[model samples]
Target: MTLRLSSMRKGIRRLAAVDVGTNTVRMLVVSETEEGFRPVIRMRRITGMGKALRETGAIGAPEFAASLDALRDFRKELDRLGVVEYRACGTAALRESSNREEFLAEAARAGIPVGIITAREESRLTWEGISGGGGTGDGTLLMDIGGGSTELIAGPGKRDFVSLPIGVVLLSASFPLSEPPRSWELSNLGHFLAERIEAGTDLWKRRRFRRMVGTAGTFTTLAALERRMRIYRPERIDGVRMTLAKVRRWEKRLAGMTEAARLALPGMEKGRERYIVFGVCQAVAAMERFRIEDLTISDAGLLEGILRGLCGRKGRG
Candidate 1:
């Protein structure tokens, strides 16, 4: 075998990963280094694909166009950056759509290949991503709270993971709330999620985790909003410990506010405000159901996992 100069200078290579999740589509580009992988470009947009799916069995006309357009733009940016390899996949929204083929066709038209991943795959990749943040063992579960679904995975090596239809969007759809949800409305939402969180409930009953590492939007936003950090600082939020008490605190505070007020609050994103109360509820439910004393938040998720896989493959070959 001939030795290549590029092999010794592999740290200069870059790769990309894209996650077409229910509520948001995100992409990340990173470069490999002796120190580890470092990020080059990151983009995320909430196109409300899942919200559209809930209202209709498919991505609505406008939603469809917007999502594909965003993707095409990302592809151009990735190309501009000279990313050597990229992987892209879609989760719950694409999985549940009755007209998923339409979305797939659009992606193909845009020259972007988007794979529809199963619930199990979503959980596993989420686990893979968070685990890369370190601390896999010693009774820690990786939890991903999405707009369309929630995943709970315990024991990374054993792969004890399940993706439930329980999500902020799902819960919001199931239990419509008034601005400042009526006590009864909140009760119904609690009861609705209580039944579906059985996977976590069962796990925590038998085993108590020392801590949990949470990924995806809900955890990240909650952590930032709690501290009133208008500017996102991934370094400060990542691996930071959040107590159950804080979860409940935010839950109660948000429940008392109207959608407009919630949106006006610091760290609250415009489109995400209304559904976030439910997100907080799910977080509280998870802490209680999983018997977790605290949570460590990780911003890395499906996109990061795919980037690692693609980058690692290139480095090896």
Candidate 2:
């Protein structure tokens, strides 16, 4: 039941959600009405919090500076648009950082409360956000791949979720692969990730979900490449099916390509080229271990989830 804009009444309240992720700072502003939530503004900037944390066990000065600048800009935008209520949440990077209090204080100065969300909260909120938007079945595996950690949720719907710490940025750094990684290297990485995923089999075996849905950059990029699209068309990629065999082939192709060659690939985002191989490898490993033959991609994730919840709350009020 997709709601249309015209159904919304006048004088609808506006809400904003800010996700300070390991690699990106994303903001979404939406209007709430009886019809549904309508997105007004959305933006993302790569801040690389995860990279700095891996090196120093803290959010480095450079990354902190970058995030502050981005947040300052986002503050101006939110004020300019007259957003009534807003919430900012930080994930793995901030949660694990040695100087999170300092960063939080900096964010407070900008009028944004940078709350460090626990892994449990991250999993629960993510499940709420995705499931609220619909399309989930009775038993489905929901996976969100971020820069610092990957979260896996399985249950009846959005109400039940479990999280994992395997993320693309962390995996890329931990598993260093030379351009065109050797077969042995690929095998080693795959085995290591598979073991981690296999640890979740107890829960997976209990529910026995038939479908897998993936959200975030990694799966979206793979969808674009698989379709050979020159531009990222969300309509085309979202809900697209990706098979384990196809992913394995793509991983091999990417693993064999030079950085220059990878940059030239269509639908490949410039900043993401370096880590795509690792992301693909992780996705493939999970799929193989879980016996998941195919996955569906979703552009909607935590941001959408937040918007939906905010709007629903306002509507009920």
Candidate 3:
């Protein structure tokens, strides 16, 4: 077999990063490149950790089993890819889970050490990922809706960010929507989200941003749905623009559909059908609260941010 000259370089490092979120576990394996880094593999498993927490107030047996299986699979991939080092970090789900320690211990047993990151650190890493891609200008607001939390970051100020405790999993569990959610139910959910966003973002409300960027699963899924993508394509979804009117339109349409109907849609992810409506509603509410007309979609999010940090550290060493 012939090897590329780049492979012969000294200190060529391959790294892995795992993001354990409220609803999903995502892992990225990347190898260094002169331009920056190239992804070897990107994988996500919907483990429903946050859903269990939201419904049962802890990590249930089923959720724990699913999460451990995902982590163990990720560990196998890391080893197979010959990753020099890897970091596995947990987010809001783990932070709020009553029995997270047991899960964390089991994750370690599976060869992945899960460290729960603060909301602030999550916001910072998210910012680093978005800004590193080099499209967002100054004062660009970023909205990242996860299963357990939503992070809003605007401007370059050190403290210009807020992480709300509300997310799609929690909202779906809290609000019992009919097959087609009633208008009043949607109204109540909107009010609930608006109040929390308003209370948490007093600083951002007083200011304005050049544009808004949306990241994480919610935004990416919305982009895919908007395009009616039969196959999920990261290259195509990234940098897509979604207007507020269109987002609201999607919210209404989705709200009116049954879970089966939503799942049957071309672009809907398998595990997200039950809660995607809430995510869309949250997006609409956030856009209205921030008075932004449209938002740009960013596929590179927290997972990419984690990989960036690992690459940087490898470079320094």
Candidate 4:
């Protein structure tokens, strides 16, 4: 559905999109431009909303408080910027949590009413974000490695998507790895990731993508690390490509480092050191599973896709 706002008659419309995921809360504010949209501000916070879901079956106290605080800050930003239209979505952790309503209620009171989206809907929005409402005519395989789930989309239609239950946060939490992870632990993690991905994509076994494109935190963070950029520039990270060999290299190197050592790396995101190894393992498994040799990074994902939808430029997938 196309979203046309009468407010556009007055000229450029300011828009905002928030993604409340299992591990992080991110908000993007942009201004409509003749050339699509120009970012006004991008903010992210690692709230670890799914930190203890496996053991507790609910959002933990620390994560719940931090998430609400982040949303409150976003609310202030939106109000200050005079954002005309906005959409905030909650993903897998919220979808599966036993006490999601409590957290959702608190989030709304904090000024960000988040709608819990299904896995498939998350896949569609992710695809829309990567392609910018433009359909992928080349049969590109899109992967979004989120905190609680990983979405693999292969076609320009809604039916050809799979949201795998395994993600970095859940995977790491499910199997606690020793620092400088042991070989057996890495092996077990690899086998688990492979089996899960294979089972999830069995329905599309006959299909193949011309190329694989990875979005969300994992891929972009990997790109930033590869470049060793102390200050991340999205323009440089987006559209960058990496071969399977390079991916595997990082996987081995990172898996051998202690959390502190990893944190000391030039481009590692502060709170991501604990889980970055698992994230790379997931990427490597995906590459091997799909028989793809290289992966491309898309800095844009669900948030950007949400903005496009608000602009009335409906995405194709």
Candidate 5:
């Protein structure tokens, strides 16, 4: 049975989930009840895990160190919070890492066994995360713009899904544009992004999606920055609506600023400055390609999906 938004409150109690990605590691603790799952705690650390991924094809010392520290902290929290039900999953960065096993072993030592999810699994999780949240109405397309890859899943039924390798961190390394990225550079970047998305599926053209829901860091951060938030407030970002015009406006505005200027902007994270340009452009490209006029930004994603999975798959080794 599909877990509808209203039904998410049933089954299980306290659940914890961790999502390790190319640029960030995040943990969430929630309690499922009659109303819905209310967040007990949320923690995120920008580890820059994929900064050198494409160039090296392995986890480097700096990023790996960050991961170890983050995972260790996450484990401590799970213990302290008395979270018996939990799941930790890794995405694109770990999927591409030659030394991912080493990282996984280290994570296990911290009391959290990390599983690298397949792109298909990632897409399904993302879709579940969105659908379970209840904002999609009849049906909506969910897009998760990650550092190492972009996952798009069309839903209500999740009729189609695809995970593209063109992520913000990877694009940043591939296209080293000058500070205040030039028009030609942004154009080229947009084209490259659109080509991949276009080639990803014909579903967008054939099926009429009612709405678009964007998940992951890129979308949420953009929403935060638009509001000029000094600190990220998930409540303020969740279910917030953004139009394609706003996406383009931010794209142009950010492209005219230097790296330092981008960092100085409210809601901009220091480690992500290098990739935000391309990341924002990719979001813009997606909205245009899908012919979506507006989108709802979602702060919930893989971690939430993992938690829901744990609640559903109660008995497992």
Candidate 6:
């Protein structure tokens, strides 16, 4: 379905969504028309804000500087395109950083207000964006694996959401797997995640969900690789079902490959190759912990979620 802006608000306006993720800064600009909203531009820069903060417990000067530069560029683009409304939100990276207020201050100085969203809000919006108001019977299990945190929410729809703190960037930095992780390392990470899963007693054990759905780059990349797509394609990845057994197999294969070998594989995005192992491990861990046999990968996530929020607000007006 084509997502379009209502004719009532159409005047060649543009809405921008900036997602300040742990590993990358992403911006999506969409034009509103009578027909709907059309994507005009999308850009992402790998900043590794989560990695830096995970190690130091604060957003270091260098990483802060780099993030500012990226945001400045994004602000310039919005001005160039004459965007009407802009919303920027930061996730796990900013949430965990001790100096997040400083970074937000710098960002505000540059004309972009960076709001730190709670994991619960992230999960709810994600489900809303993907389901588009269609209720998931027995509820749905939603997973978003960002660089700094992986959010898992199980609910009937958007209203009853729960979030977890396990993320790929956090795990990668904490584990420090050079190539193949030793059995001890894997065991430790698994135990760590298991505890998190156990804490979600009610949600994890709910018999309501018939299936699991995942959003974010990690799942999208895995789906693309599984399908052997030469280039990233949202159409191919969205709503694609991935079985737990299949993901485990792929995770095992990646665990054995060096970073160089992974980079050489077709469909592996350049910067993403380095973190594939971490992503796979997290996915596998979630599956094993929850006993989720199958997951559907979706590319529509935070950006779409933001847009939907805007639309909902507009509708209320």
Better of 3 and 5 by lDDT: 3
Q: List the global CA lDDT of all models.
A: 0.76, 0.76, 0.83, 0.86, 0.81, 0.75
The segments of candidate 5 whose C-alpha lies over 4 angstroms from its true place after superposition are 1-13, 133-135, 156-159, 315-317
lDDT of 6: 0.75
Which residue segments of model 3 deviate by more than 4 Å? 1-12, 133-135, 155-157, 315-317
TM-score of each: 0.91, 0.88, 0.93, 0.94, 0.91, 0.88
lDDT of 2 by residue, 150-234 (tens): 8887743444555566777777777888776888888888888788877855455555667678888888888888887786665
lDDT of 3 by residue, 14-132 (tens): 87778998888888777877777777677888888887677678987887899999998888877766788888899999999999999999999999999999998898888877787
> Tens digits of per-residue lDDT for model 4 on 1-317?
01222232234568899999999999988888877887878888998999988889899999999999999999997887778888999999999899999998998899889999998888888888888777766758899998899999875576779898787889888989998899999999999999999999898888877678999888888998989988777888898999999999999999999999998998888889988888899999989988899799989889988887888753311
- What TM-score would candidate 6 get against the native? 0.88
Give the candidate number with the greatest lDDT: 4
- Summarize candidate 1's per-residue lDDT along 180-225 as a digit string, tens digits: 7999888888776777786445655677787878888888888778
For candidate 1, the lDDT comes to: 0.76
Count clashes in each candidate, considering only residues at least 3 apart in sequence or on different chains.
0, 1, 0, 0, 0, 8
**Candidate 3 overall lDDT versus native:** 0.83
Candidate 6, 316: how far from true, in Å? 15
Worst 10 residues of 3 by lDDT: 1-10
**Candidate 5 per-residue C-alpha lDDT over 1-317 given as tens digits, one digit per residue, 9 for 90 to 100:** 00112222333466788889998998887776665567877878888888888899988899999988988988887776667678889999999999999999989998889999998888888877767734456557788999899988875334578789998888888988997788888788888888888888665677666668899888887988988888777888897888889888888888899989988999887776777888888888878887888889988878777777777766532
Q: In angstroms, give how far residue 230 of model 1 lies from its true place.
A: 1.8
- Ten-residue region with minimum lDDT total, candidate 1: 1-10
Q: Which pairs clash in the backbone of model 5?
A: none
Q: Score candidate 1 by TM-score against the native.
A: 0.91
Clashes of 2: 1
